[model samples]
Target: MGRTKPPRLDGESEDDYYMRLIQKLANEKLALFARYQMEQQQEEEERKEVATNLLSLKKSKKSSLKRKQRDFDEDDVIDIKIKNKKKKKVGVTTTNKAEQRPVVVNKVTEGVKEFIKNKMKGSDLKLLIQKTLYASDLNPGQNRLNMPANQLETNANDFLTADEMRKLTDKDKKSGLEVDKDKKSGVEVGILGPNLRMYDRMLELKIWDMPCTKNYVLISNWYNFVKEHYNFLKKGTLIQVWAFRLNEQLCLALVCPDHEDDNVAFEENLHDGENDDVAVAASASEV
Candidate 1:
């Protein structure tokens, strides 16, 4: 038989003692959980505040710039003052996604210059390219993606509808590739061939840098997505990509697996399952 210890005199009852201990532990755990919830609430409030503050700030900055421009039509000195004001770092400027730019074109000869170059063949093609260049929406100096409604042309109102270089007859070749056009649908489609350098060049300019995995979507501001080359799904195709950087400079890209090929490999494995089982049995015998 096990020996029982004697109870202490002047001590609390056993049930009372254990209940107190249980309550103490419960209190501590509750305190911890309360602290976690408080922290989460505070973080959410802070994020909301930041987003609101940034939107208002960007609006103010734009208004201020417009006023200055209006007042001084030709005063270089006033312009210099405004420039200096921006240059003076007053901490993070109020910013917004409304004016967020995807890419700059004028600084890079506008995105559709290749189409313009092709217009030189005889004067007829030249006129078409000329109208496209002059008649289309003029990009805001600040953002190539922006096109005021008035600037859009009759034939090609949206940049998406116009300037589909991929659709130009293969009979006249600037770039060598076959484009599958849908006659019934009146739309063009295909995966974009990889232009690996596009991302690297942006990085070189310190424009953007980010890594994409899963479905890395490049929402081009000015490219014709309808006729985009989807050949990345081909057996062994490759291309470069681009992204915006955290710091206005140092944009970069990396080589990543194409999801299209992953699908192909999965199907191939299914077909080879029988062969794999036979090989496994032979290996088991050898062991």
Candidate 2:
């Protein structure tokens, strides 16, 4: 007969015995390996789906940024074209205005100058030209002491006589010398000489000639005269001043720079002296 089958445990059926043996065998080996493999495959599939979604999101962001940049570039191009057109319009308007503006000319000044040129006499015109040239050549703070030759040669008697002055002083009468006197007080004309100085718009001149002795004249009048001939008034220049005392103060009635020809001669003499000195020095050096 065949080998006898193993006996079952107490109270165990034949099917229960086979099922327990199989469960014990599976526990000893790999019982749930197929189930673990199926779970890993599911996790891999979820990771691939997440990666694909992230890639699509990145592509959409890039495309949106490119579209925004393209719109901005088009707007910039339109703005640049509009500005260029406006500038061209403004330039055309300015050019038309400049072309329409009229030119102006002065005729009165030219006519007046021509009239003066025609009216002036020969000797008078020559003298005037000389004076104008001299004045033009003079720098500020420098002066030319030039007077009419006739005025310089006038005798002291012609200017004022003692007898005439006495008559004018006592009687307040007009003299032959045209010495102006105040009618209220009969005063003789006095003379102001060289060494004149201006102080605070007041001219103070020392009196050395005529009847006055050791006196100084503070001239308050003749502002216009002084202003007109200001360039001629120089220090150490001979100024023949016709003045009279009013309230014990000398009032300058008339004044003029005199002896200009003599001053010119003196300057020439000085220049010659300087030349002589230079010649002597040169000769001495040669020796």
Candidate 3:
């Protein structure tokens, strides 16, 4: 106890402990600041790398565009060369060969007109359509004649009466035919064969309205007409159809030059058989 030094004061010891705590906090703050700086530096490097990649992509795109332009120019040059070669190959001989081919004139036969005037006592003979029969036309399953709207003559509608036109163009009628008290489905029309004889049975005239186009079809007893003329009504047979009126009724005359002579001996009376009867009502979809 004689040699003991004076005891340290409590205030001084507390002050020393506080100073040590402050120094520890300052060390922790410095470490946190250094970590933040390192993170910011890494982010800057990442940004620089992204900018470089974008620049490289732009350069590649420009090169690809130039390559495409060069390829397109080469293709144009090739096309021009081919055209010049074709022009050189074409000569007067080719034109003369084309000119030497016989020109085919499309005209209605006189017999058809005589049939309309003398036999049927029908007038206003007008060419309706001239077409080569297709497989569909000759097919027994499709027993109807299709008159394409585009192929119809400019005055095709001139043959139709006002009532007939209404029946064909009217959207209200489902079958494009006038329904009367007798339950008639379509216009009662007669089809005259190349032999100048009226069809044994009546036929129906209706319009088939499609999404892209419209067609006037002959149905109802068409199968019988086709069956009777099956020998000459085959596919690829060119035929002319003329429209005329008989007793104010619509009549169509079919003319086939190939079978004109063959059918001459098979002529029947124009007013014979069931020509006055109502046509058998058939669905247009059957064709």
Q: Residue by residue across 138-240, what tens digits does model 2's lDDT show? A: 2232211222222222332443346534543344245534232221123222212111211123343312111111112222232333354456544332333
Please identify model 3 stretches exceeding 4 Å from their true place.
1-108, 173-185, 260-263, 266-287
Q: In model 3, what is the error at residue 110, expressed in angstroms?
A: 0.7
Query: lDDT of each structure?
Result: 0.27, 0.31, 0.57
Higher-ranked by lDDT: 1 or 2: 2
Highest TM-score model number: 3
Clashing pairs in model 3, backbone N/Cα/C closer than 3 A:
none
Each candidate structure's TM-score, on Cα atoms with residue i matched to residue i, is 0.20, 0.17, 0.51
Instruction: Count clashes in each candidate, considering only residues at least 3 apart in sequence or on different chains.
Output: 19, 0, 0
lDDT of 3 by residue, 36-137 (tens): 443343334334434544455556675535553434333354355344534542111111122121322332376557546764457878877776676566
Residue 69 accuracy (lDDT) in model 3: 44
Tens-digit lDDT string for candidate 1 (215-237): 11122322332123233322232
Clash tally for model 3:
0
Write the number of the candidate with greater lDDT, choosing between 2 and 3: 3
